[model samples]
Target chain A: MDKVIKGKVWKFGDDIDTDLITPGKWLGSPELKDHVLETEDPDFPKQVQKGDVIVAGKNFGCGSSRETAPEALLQMGIVATFCESYARIYYRNSIGLGLPPLIVPGVSKEIEKGDEIEFSFETFKLKNLRTGKELQAERIPDFLLEILEGGGQEKILKKKLKQKLKELRAKKE
Target chain B: MVRPMTIAEKILARAAGKEEVKPGEYLIAKIDLLMAHIAAARIVARFMGFPAKVRKVFDPEKVVVLEDHFVPAPTVFAANAQKMIREWAFKQNLKYFYDIKAGICHQILPEKGHVRPGMLIVGTDSHTTTYGAYNAAGTGIGDTDGTVAAALGELWFKVPETIRFVLDGKLPKYVMSKDIILKIAGDYKADVACYKSIEFVGKAAEDMSIASRATLSNFSMELGAKFAFTPPDNKIIDFLKGRTEKPVTSDDLVKPDEKAEIEKIYELDVSDLEPQVACPHTVDNVKPVSELKDVEIQQAFIGSCTNGRLEDLKIAAEILKGHKVHKKTRLLIIPASQEIYKAAIKEGIIETLIDSEAIICNPNCGPCFGAHMGMLAPKENCISASNRNFKGRMGSEDAGIYLASPAVVAASAITGVITDPRTL
Candidate 1:
């Protein structure tokens, strides 16, 4: 994982729930990537470029624990999300899927749409290149950082569990 | 000196094998249950993506897989997903597997005795907080977290601050537990309890039936509660007595100490409470039923993990006993589980609803999420008993959804408009 992330900003407002991110009607559809944030911003999926960042207001990703919410963002080439605050499960899902959901208080106010922002995972520092405004973000826990470092929980769990299986086989031998 | 711990702190402390736990501190805790539904198929697919020949779940007994979200396979895509989930459950030899007959994961988990006090449970669905009604620590998880918890029998948690809501005085006639939560949402708004555990205590909470208490815990998700609890009492014990094969006694009940540290306390007297409704677009945009005028509805749905219990059906039946559903509105009633459906049949509640021209669907999450069954058309308005009134939650983004109790839904169906149950 990179120590710093730099991306173009795609801004959203507070209380942008899972239903808005991934509507319930298209729960299991392959078309989910096309519908990501379609209700809230019809142009999001079509216009969002690779390595873009999502900046949103408080309680972002609030509502359902559908992994599809973050999965859609990841599928659409979103590198990370910066929110004033996050709903607990969405935060976990974002991190588990290898998307960094950085908590930067007043971030929604600091960054504007289309602004290029650079965030340092090491210093928890976020700088708006467009506005020249810098802010200190909340630190991600060391253990969670390890998950992010290992390229998310899926790869880590696969490696760990395979090792466990080998150990079990060795003990039996 | 050790500070007095709230129920969440004590439960997490016990699960983590620690003397105490405080807010903002993180710890790895052993999980008693790992639940997944239609979503488990994704976890299984992700797990199988690994090239390990010895892929095994930590404990099949702790895993619960149910097919409730996309039951009956509304689409070929959903059907294929369900097939994969069924095959994986068979291969894993999971101890707890339900194939759409059981019901929503949250409702059937308690009804079938999977939830126990002081246990830590996680699920792929957000409403898993419903288990907290039994004094268990339950929270929602996503697929990757679910997959890891399925492999390792433990998950990490950041101890959340507790908010204590104390309710006393008698609930007025026709006012249900749904109203209490709606009133709270109206006053405090959603996100007031974000990432916090909310503990409901006091006489009114104790007086609520198990089903009603489940409603309180279930809808707390709308308030952004990571976990919600109504202290266990004789009511919970009695409810679990014959329902669970495992021996559960009153001594196993977990409660907060009198001096437990809570971040906030809210005291409410429910004697004067009215029937509350969460209007369209958001759960917190709530208003008393009497204040909502001329809001005509095209559909009325009474079901979901939130309020689909037999008690809710009985309330709806009582209001619709003799009256016919308005010609302008279509009424759909779904019991939460097969057991609740059977119980409603035995009690003649189903017959009364059927006589009123209400459509009774199978016990699944019917149309609450707009996945299947009764979806609202463009510009249509629906008064529903299910939680969540988020925009586009129940089909057409232009459609409006008003959330209320079963009685209100039934009464509104009869009048073709949002009506106070007492007026019916």
Candidate 2:
């Protein structure tokens, strides 16, 4: 598993709902990638490069549990989100989809918009390359890390079923 | 060690196949019931990609699929999604399929006697918590999470702390359960119950009707709660009496442990409270009904799982009887289920509402979703009985949405703007 992620920070405030991330109207759109985060920041989909990180204040992903919220970020080449807190469903969806939402302590206030951030999943630390300050985030939960290693819950189920079938075939033989 | 367990923790512990559980602990619990609206089910069925249909599931008897979101297929996508799920449910031999003739999933589940105390129910929509009114340990889930829970019959949860909301007094006339929840959401702030369960107790909760209880649990999401419940009171038992084959006594209900560590406690006196409304842009931006008394509104909507019930419809019908909706305003009434629709019709409540020039529609989440029908035009203002009042919630981002009770929404529809229901 990749433990280190370095990216340019994109800032947002509290309650960054799924509607703003990817509105309901654009749920099945092939052009969703272009409109991703368009409601929040018009330039986001255009300017966001391959390793951009979203750092938002408390209660991030606050409304409506749409998987498209994280899908929008992932498809736009945004890799990670650092929030003070997260709504339960959105948090579960993010880790289950392989896009990790790390709960960093006050990283939103400490880091400037567009600052270079180096995140270490193992150490639970974020280094501000521009400001030369280090901030600590909560250690990734063990269950979530395990899920990530298994390529998320979907893969885990596939592997579990496959193993079960193999065991049954071997026993029958 | 499990020191003490609330009704929620106990149900979770039992479902997790453990003797006990505590707050903040994560466990994979067995799901007793799995439900999804047609739109959400379609998304879940196709979540694995490649234009798939979820033709087989673990237990067909345990799964429920409801065609409530877009009943007759408003959009092409909705039509396709509903058709695919209907076909898939049939293939899976799903036990409960409330086709378009039925209404909202939350309302129909209880009305059909599927919900029971001590059960662990999971649904694709955010208002699944509404089942908590039956004393079931229920919580809303996202599409992907719901799909997994439905297929595998299990889902992971981080046990939440409890917030005890003690409703100490009798609710005065015109102050419905909707008002109490709004007061809690507005006064106490959204995070008060965030990641926690709010266990309702005291006289008010005990006296509230089943439909009214539904409203409280339905809006629990506004508090950011993981779960919210009032132990299945006598009202719920009585409602289920003949509808259910099994004997349901008060003893079947569960309660929170007296010794359990509650994160916080709040006492609300319903008798002293007035009508409340959540203003534009947020459910938590609540104010007294008088605050916006003069603000003109173009429409008043009484529907959604939050308010579309016989009890709520009666409240509107009573106010609109022998009177007309304001010429400047149009009143839209939606019964939550075909069951609610029939009940209102039998009682002549629907006729009275129609006589008042109120347009009635079948049970579905209409304007609440800003889809199909009832889209607000630019700069339009509406007073709605639905849950969320978030900006662009009903349509154009420029439109304003205000949340209130059915009685308040109806009274306001008569004169336009926000009017206190007490005056009428």
State TM-scores per candidate: 0.98, 0.95
lDDT (tens digit, per residue) of candidate 1 on B340-410 = 99999999999999999999999899899887888889999999999988888999999999999998999
Compose the digit string of candidate 2's lDDT tens values, residues A1-173: 47899999899887776666776556676877886767677788889998899999877776665677886788788888988888777788888778888898888789877899998878979999998899888877687788877766766665655665677678889
Clashing residue pairs in candidate 2 are none
CAPRI-style grade of the A/B interface in model 2? acceptable
Which numbered prediction scores highest in DockQ against the true structure?
Answer: 1
Candidate 1 Cα outliers beyond 4 Å, as residue runs:
none
CA displacement after TM-score superposition, residue A103 of candidate 1 (Å): 1.0
- Candidate 2, residue A13: how far the Cα is off, in Å: 1.2
How well does candidate 1 reproduce the true complex, by DockQ?
0.76
Whole-model lDDT values for every prediction: 0.90, 0.82
